[model samples]
Target: MELDHLLRDAVRRLADAGIPSPRADAELLASWVLGLSRGELALKALTGLEVSGADAERISDLVAERCRRVPLQHLTGSAPFRSLELRVGPGVFIPRPETESVVEAVLGQLRRLGEEGIRRPRIVDLGTGSGAIAAAVAAEFPAAEVHAVELSAEAVAWARMNFEVLPDHAAQVTLHHGDLRRSPELLGELSGTFDVVVSNPPYIPADMVPTEVEVREHDPQMALYGGGEGGLELPFAVVAAAEELLRPGGWFIMEHAELQAGPIAEHCAAQPLLESVHTHRDLTGRDRATSAVLARAQRGDVAKWRA
Candidate 1:
């Protein structure tokens, strides 16, 4: 089938399956199959570009799997995030576009710090699944030293692959295979050293099932559910870890569910070491991330590492 006809049928199939952005996803898959940019694919589609039979068969299987609510990134074996295409598959949480704005938030803060004569800032990403945020920081902020922590071997493997593709400053970044809950133990050597501490940790509660099949089924549970109480437990620990890691007057930014704005802002603001808590909204206007400044060095919650 020709590219236009193939994408049209795939769009219909995906839409019928209730997939959002069917045309975009379909076009993206076509681009992946041909290794052409979406814009390039569109230009070729205007000329009725013919797809080879072998490639057509592969595209069909991918489209079929997408219709079943499989993640497009999973099918393409990569996810685009902040100018980088990250390798992704089972056992790793796929990077979402919303988190890109969180990276922007950090970059904005980095600029603010730059004005204050802070160069080559130290940064750490807790629970760095697929190392998306960590790698992005390393690539975008050339001088920042980045450290990433993850617990799952499978996810860490994918993160390592993603880190390998980072164009610059990746060697300045460290990937630690350890649990965030044990930040006190695992990250003790670097305690109170980082200028920026960030995370997009699992914040979904155990009882709250995700509506998307891609997330609920394909994504690893360890990368989804926050432990206990509305999945706030893990986020709370992230805050504590950030508190310990951030130097006085350092920054902490974390992505969480929209509804988590209130809880996160309130809890982090109350911490003696963290202040100026503010929630940030994504492009869709949902409260997607919150930022705070660590005001001082202080001991806080300690927990066993289950991850």
Candidate 2:
């Protein structure tokens, strides 16, 4: 079959299946099968390339899975976040574009720390999931020390794989298997030492069910729900962990549902040890994250830590 015709047919099938961004997904699936970049595949489609029988069959199978509501990332075996492409599948939560803003918030604080002569900043990602935030920071700000903690053993396996396969910068990431709520204990002496602590913890409310077929059906439950009222339990615990892990004058940021902005910001602002509390909006302009700076140590506070 002509590549163009097959692509059009795939798009029609995917769109009819209620898949969002059908054309992009169709092109990406074909690119994966052909081992070509999407741009190169597009060029081939323009030149009347023919789909080889074997490759055509593979594309059809992948398209069938997509029609069944399998995540496109799971189909392709990778999801792009920031400058990194992370491995994701049945047991891991796929990184979403909205969470990139949370990474940016961390990077921004790291850059500020650099200006203040803190050259080798230490940072940790709580509930790292696929290690997307941790790996991105390591890859982008190579000078920063990166650490990640995941509670789910299944998700930790995927996080380990991604940290291992990435380049040397990302390979610097230290992956730990533990619950973020116990980060202070899990991190031990590293507690009270991080220059920035960040996370994209599971914050979906217990009563709320995601509407996307891919999310509702395919993503792991442990990576989805944050039990308790308003799903703030894990998020609140993460905030406490950030307080424990961050050094005086360090920064902290976390991603959550838009509706969480008020509660989270209020909670952070109320903390005597954290200041400059603020809520940040993602690309879509929704309240997507909250950030704050741990208060700088006082003369007496510094002496106490030394003791």
Candidate 3:
């Protein structure tokens, strides 16, 4: 019943259950239970300390949930995004490391604009699942006005929880509940107002969703399956919305399925209001994010014609 033995057993069980990074996950759980850092856990492991009965029970329950395909982030109620640890749960999408590049791309674009004497840019995160992108943008650019939109009521609640726990800068983030493609009132509020628009929308083809155990079993389906053909409807909607939401010379960036980069670029090209459509690869060298500048004067032209 020693801590090291318990951790070893937990790791073995997780591995047997087909969980990736079993040892690392076990270590993280152990550290959380013991209220120690991972390095501290290593040192304490050598001492052969016994876990309290209550702590052992808690870890056992967590392990059982993991075996049931529940995400560790959900079990722990938190996920790390950029430098922030945001609360997560059943209704929210767990933030992934790959999406960090999306945040970086937004920040880089902001920095470039800053060099041109633009500061305190207004930014929006469409379909902001866990509010990861919005929160990160607020933290990185304290002066910016950040807003996030989510269609799911549960997701909006989870995002609001994350927003509450953030630092003072998080106060800058405004959360709206409604679909970007359909909510006219919500759309009107942001019409021609943002300097940057970013999103990590659901892009997995509807049929392909069932094949990924981690996604199908643990993540919310509404946050994953785009539609049939997976041709970038969500990202396209964000692009079209951005045409109305972003100021001329503003930028829109989106994280998408790596294989859909060409189609995403093509979609942006068709927008006519978006120029310089470009794809950015993730750390693993997969095309993961795309960005384009809004044609400034044309936004008004497009909006007026649509009106």
Candidate 4:
């Protein structure tokens, strides 16, 4: 069959199967199959019409999987985030476009700090997932030391894989296997030393987990569920951890559910050691990330260590 015809048929199949953005998905899958960019696909459409042999078979299989609602990133084994191509697979949270805003917000905050003479800052990413935020930050601030922590062994392993693909500075990014609710021994080594602490911890309410097919079927529950009530348990723990981890005047940034802005701001307000609590919106103008500037240190705030 002609390549254009085959591609159109694939798109139609996906649409009939209830896949959103079928044409785009088909184009992306085709490009992946042909090892070409979308622009290249357009340029060589006439040539692509002749796809045969193993290439044809591979394209057909990938299309079938897409029709089944498997995420395209899972099929491609990569997801782009903030100019970086992150390796993603089973057992790791797929990087979402919405999360890109979280990274941008952090970068913006860091730039503002830089304007005030802050240089070569230290950063920590809690519940780092596939290390997307940590890697992106490390890449942007080459001189900054980036530490990423994940409680899931699968997530930690996946994060390490993604970290390896990063540039040299990102290769230097630290990955720790530990829980956010419980302090890690590694965090103790750099107590009160971080200039910025960022996290996109699990915030989805437990009751909502089973409702999202993409999340329930594909993503790990531990990376999505925030326990009963889903009312900022993990985010609060991360904030408390950041209070201990951040240096005086350091920053703490976190991405949460859009509806979480109010409670998160309230939580930060309650922390005597944190000030300047603020919420940032995503590209869609929905509040998605929160940040605060460290105000002062409390006495007897021993940085707890965990194995």
Identify the candidate with maximal TM-score: 2
**Local accuracy of candidate 1 as per-residue lDDT tens digits, 1-307:** 8889988998998999999899999998888889999999999999999999988888888989999888988999998899888899988999989999999998898888899998888888999999999999888887888899999999999999988876664467788899997875787778877889999999998889988888899999999999879899999999988877777788999999998899899998787666788889999999999999876433333211211
Worst 10 residues of 2 by lDDT: 298-307
Whole-model Cα lDDT of every candidate shown, in order: 0.87, 0.90, 0.84, 0.82
lDDT of 4 by residue, 226-294 (tens): 754655788888898888788778898899998889989998998777899988888888999899988
lDDT by residue for model 3 over 1-307, one digit each (tens)?
7889989999999999998889888888878777888999888889988889999888888888887778788877888899898998887788999999999989988888788888778888999998999999888888778888999999999898888876774458888899988533695776677889898988887656466465677788889877656746677777787777788888989888888898989988887677988999999999998899888676548667567
Candidate 4 segments whose C-alpha is farther than 4 A from its true place: 46-48, 297-307
TM-score (all chains, Cα) for each model = 0.91, 0.95, 0.94, 0.92
Model 1 CA lDDT for position 253: 95
lDDT of 2 at 270: 84
Error of 2 at 33 (Å): 0.3
Q: Which of the two, 2 or 3, has more lDDT?
A: 2
lDDT order, best first, reads 2, 1, 3, 4
Q: Is candidate 1 or candidate 2 better by lDDT?
A: 2
Query: How does residue 82 of candidate 4 score in lDDT?
Result: 84
* Residue 64 in candidate 1, Cα distance off native in Å: 1.4
